[model samples]
Target chain A: MLLIRAIVRPEKKDEVLAELSSAGFNAATMVDVVGRGKQKGIRIGGMVYDEIPKTLILMVIPDDAKETVITMILSIAKTGTGGTFGDGKIFVSPVDEVYTISKGTAGL
Target chain B: MKEIMAVVRMKKTGATKKALVAAGVAGFTAVKVMGRGNLVTDPKAIEACKEKLLSMGMDEFSESWDTEKMVTSFLDGSRFFPRRLFTILVHDDDVPRVIEAIVTANKTEYGIGDGTIFVLPVSDAVRVRTGEAGEAAIW
Candidate 1:
């Protein structure tokens, strides 16, 4: 299985989540975080630079589903008026195993 | 607060549940999540993306008004998607040992792996039922 990690714009979070759910790919983890990039953060009219507030969403998908999930995330998190900075990002890694508690199921 | 606490994953959700139970977490909170590491900065690019979304009929205003509803609706319906998360309130001291257990058991390398563990400094906590405080906050 592949574990997907995405950092996205807080504003567009709903769109991404909704799209993912509608696509039938729910089940993931999320948190709020602070980070800076090469642009070194952001600058407004009067402000200099500062760290950004981002929401980190994580999930594990079957290996065969990587491309589809990636595409969905990108489509939902594209930058702009629709998705601002930190719209969303995805990271895929190997998930050796997964176990959901309410129902005792192993692997995907 | 006990000395050892952990968040573990197993092929058998039963095992993971058993582990958490054995670890002694009273209750846990989790939210669905997703992400990509690649980030960028370009006004034109951002604008174009917004235009594309607009064309698709994703009304920004409606989403802004009610994101929780949107997220739940989307996640419940999607498939073959991204990562999942679980946040457990454990005895703070257990953080290190639990990390050890998960890494060794999962066979993940340092700074690289299928999954990771992160720690956050607990500022303060509260008990919803009685409005308790401090260590009492954890229970």
Candidate 2:
């Protein structure tokens, strides 16, 4: 399994979640977060907004679904048709083990 | 070091933290989240339910809406289960100890929503407080 963490805009969250669900990938954990990427936050009308509200969607999925899921998120989470800054980022990490608490079992 | 992230029942948060802290795991971040398992995800069935709800003049749909809302709000009430996600990073050797602590903390005899723990490899880590990176940074 692999864990895919996507940091995306708050406004784009609904779409991202919907698309994922439609694509048959509904299992995700979401948290409200604030972050900035290469843009280094945003400056509007001489005001600097250092912290931006973004939703962190986390999913522990089978390794094979990584690419498909990432692509789906990218397509739906982008700010515009061609994409723009602050659209969000996806981090993929290899999972060594998974334990199901309900079953008292490990490696599932 | 490895990043150990666990999504557990909301009620288990306190106990899980105490166990990890007692185990000497350095630090962790816990976030409240809404989630569900794949077992409850049936797209076709969910769509039909969504349409039914909408036809009844339910304002569930806002200007911006997507399928996620349908899946997450399938039951109208308690559609998505509440969970607490704990993220901990520890040295590679400490993985077993940490997992043991978490399992012990989360284990329930009845085992309804014990939660799940995931162990992932960390290529590198950097601690900003002391300008440390790699193993030292994690400390």
- Identify the runs in model 1 with alpha carbons over 4 angstroms from their true place: A81-88, B1-139
lDDT for each residue of candidate 2 in B29-131, tens digit (9 for 90 to 100): 9888877655433355345655766565445555325454653465432235788989898998998888888888888764344667888888999888877
lDDT of 1 by residue, B18-104 (tens): 445555544665444432211122334344434444455456566642644444333322322343345655566665444444444
- lDDT for each of the candidates? 0.53, 0.78
Question: For model 2, what is the alpha-carbon lDDT of residue B121?
Answer: 85
Candidate 2 backbone collisions, by pair:
A18-B67, A18-B68
Q: Give the per-residue lDDT digits (tens) of candidate 2, residues A1-108.
A: 988999998898888877887777766778888887788799999998879889998888888998899989888888767889888899987899888776757754
Which structure among the candidates has the greatest DockQ?
2
Instruction: List where candidate 2 sits over 4 angstroms from the true fold.
Output: B41-78, B109-112, B126-139
